[model samples]
Target: MTKIFEMPLYPYTRTADQDAAAPVRHTAMIVGAGPVGLAAAIDLAEQGVPVVVLDDNDRVSFGSRAICFAKRQLEILDRLGCGQPMVDKGVVWNLGKVFFGDRRVYDFNLLPEEGHHRPAFINLQQYHLEDRLVARVRDLQRQGAEIELRGGNRVQAVDDLGDRVRLGIDTPEGPYTVETDWLIACDGAGSPIRSMLDLDFVGRVFEDNFLIADVVMEAEFPTERWFWFDPPFNPGQSALLHKQPDGVWRIDLQLGWDIDKEEEKTPERVIPRLRQMLGDEVAFELEWVSIYTFQCRRMERFRHNRVIFAGDSAHQVSPFGARGANSGIQDADNLAWKLGLVIQGRAPEGLLDSYDAERIAAADENILNSTRSTDFITPKSEISRLFRDAVLDLSEHYDFARPLVNSGRLSLPSVYDGSPLNADDALEGGPARTRPGAPCPDAPAGEGYLLDRLGGAFTILTLDAEAPERVSEAGIDAARVALSAGDDPTGALAERYLGAARSAIYLIRPDQHVAGRWPAYDEARIRAAIRRATGQE
Candidate 1:
């Protein structure tokens, strides 16, 4: 039977730009139609920004490359109009178990709170994700969105002009030239665009490697994440197990530094390891296998003039925390709205700089967490190994030591603390979680969720606070969404948004991050905050 990812969803078709007398210019052009690039393109197009995506291949990625998608990323996808399909086709899980030697040390739940729409994490193959994102692009195009996905269009060279970028592309038909006001690179780790511009990543690469095997098997294991430390199956190393859609299961076995990677990937080498772990009773077949090293690295800056790098092009981290694709999607979420506003002349070009600041900070956080997880999983010396073992042993009984065990800290949304766009926290008694620089937590509103009404534009959310229906500043409109405590039956809105204050108002950015909050609406302060959030101040 034919599979979704096996089909060429976006086959090559020659465009008129190939026959143009000169290079055709586009508002935005994204390289590499992976999850990040497709997401950015969809975001910009939804905001009425014209975008074109170029990719060397026509089909989705092979294998279950990245299986875990976190909750925050699911919310972002909801805003993009494609979250439900992914969640429906994914294995939702929040419970995770950590094992020391042969016994379970501790178990944790990622999302224990209620009133949230999405789960803590979902396990779906990378190919399925790409397939859904491409479906979204088709939906947007049907709705008259100005978005294009050009498969088999590989960029051969990039010339970053001061005001714009010129690209030399190669297609099955032939070679052509084009120009873009802004160029976004979502290419994989070996970013050709990054290389063409003479850039490099800076960080640590661990000496150990891990074998990833996507096994097709029928098993009764519950939907949960399982991590092992120095288990008897693969002694003195780590192992991870995750369930994916269909009958596929993702397994990771830690192989020490000095092993033959090529030989380790063969069935002769991989089957025996799996038999030791799963036992002879369980029937399984290897679907895909690969070996990877732990590397925590990122570019010094994500932005370089008109050429902006995102996703793996800008940063990379160990696969432990599921930070790779999740963070990359966040990069798209951060860049699209700012780039849209800049292109529309509603915000200054400086607003794009905040993308570099916020996402770089996020990348740093992911890298740090990944580095720590790798260190705990594969200790450097005898002292470190002893410390890890001690923590694991104590965690089985003592609650105090459980926090010390790090089986991949797991992915979390980064709070943009000290961001230049943040306004003063005038809501003195407001909840700390919804501070000026924090991403707004989801809560139950009147009928649906609060986040559903918050994105795509600046919003003024009023809770028992009277405010105008709309406020316009410098040609940008900030709409008002008024709700009282009675609107939420669960009191979540009051708890998440207005903790101590009886009445509150919030200014939300297009990307749904909090810009400012106040006890009452003041026109002057709101205008000033709008200016600051848009880089006008």
Candidate 2:
């Protein structure tokens, strides 16, 4: 039998409430110490905002939950100061193969070309990611970043005033109430705070179940995602295989709604099923098993008065596309900068509304993709299954039907197309890939990557033309480069940013979203764009 992972318990500490102390007020308080909450604390502290994080549990997650981390999420982690270690400890891959019955239908590469720093996807356990973020938070605390992480503490009640929030926290010693200018809830889907406020999570719940098992074995399988529909061993069912760190393999088997959940997870039942797929003689040990039913749901709004919601508390999606945790990290990234500015009184309160707008749009997009993937994988009616099998059969021969296959569209950064913060499309005949409302694409910049040079605050990217001295006088960060015609070294930055002939200038937000772009540097227009991006206009 494979040894189960043993997590150390975090000791509960005495708080000021146990003693006769006055109520301590904070600039911001974050509830839940999951990946999203830890990330939010780090981002806010890095921006010079004092933060306090509280969680009921002390250690990281227990199992290999939420393993697939996308490149965009890795970039966000890098900005928070812990991406490199996660990448070093993760299994990186870009290729996936889909099989129809016994024959290979098609194979595709996510990132065919590689001039970037991070890979398309990395398979690291969610616990490892949370540990790294927690460590980063501690490191920042030693460096004078005012971040206090209190474990074994849960928020029993929350009272939201017009301009501040009051949290009644329960600890081992006693209960105490503290006030904060703002409250961020990173609790999971069954959030008590959401329930206390009587907020309803609205969406569709699929009636299908999927069994996931982690096995420790020495196998010769390549580092690629292998998926099968109606394999010989498990007829009329779908199976997925993925490689993870530390000689572990994740196998997901589709189970219909009629099966008993508890009986299916037993080793006696699971080992036989695995043996049917892998040869009977192959040696392996079952590490963990879980049964899950897919759901695509989200709250109507993320922001509620002085209290805000993030991560699973705000939205949720099926695991098919690996969108749940990745999108949650993006949500924290989007809200941190805006919340920091609001706490510092640098912007108006209306700025918080934009977070609600953009993240709701992103949640809708994720839910739509996840629902489509679940439907294709677990078809409801006979007509749906017929069409799915037809597409898979034709994909083996015809290239046209290959795109019709829906085996988890895979997570990609969403573009906020209708964001009120973006400038109107002004420049014609330039690179539309990095257009307004899109995340800044990574490109070779000097010895590093483009995204590495463009975060933490507002920046202006000027390429191929001389930046006027008056540009900096406008009080905005500018990365100016005047490249010669034949001096195209990496040959990617200019092409991706489309700054070939004349000067191309782009105003970037703190979260690295492109606010506006112009062909020439205009100090007046750039400042105006900055105001619009920050909700100051």
lDDT by residue for model 2 over 83-192, one digit each (tens)?
99999999999999999899999999989865678999999888778878888988998999999888888889888778788888888777988888999999988998
Model 1 per-residue lDDT tens digits across residues 1-537: 997778999999999999999999999999999999999999999999999999999999988898899999999999999999999999999999999999999999999989998999999999999999999999999999999999999999999889999999999999999999999999999999999999999999999999999999999988999999999999999999999999999999999999999999999999999999999999999989999999999999999999999999999999999999999999999899999999999989999999999999999999999999999999999999999999999999999999999999999888999999999889978999999878888888888998887867899999999999999997689999999988988988898899999999999988888999999999999999999999999
Write down the lDDT that model 1 would get. 0.94
Deviation in angstroms for 228 in model 1? Answer: 0.5
Task: List, in order, the clash count of every candidate structure.
Answer: 0, 0
Error of 2 at 212 (Å): 1.2
lDDT of each: 0.94, 0.85
Residue ranges of candidate 1 with Cα displaced over 4 Å: none
Angstrom error of the Cα, residue 311, model 2: value is: 1.1
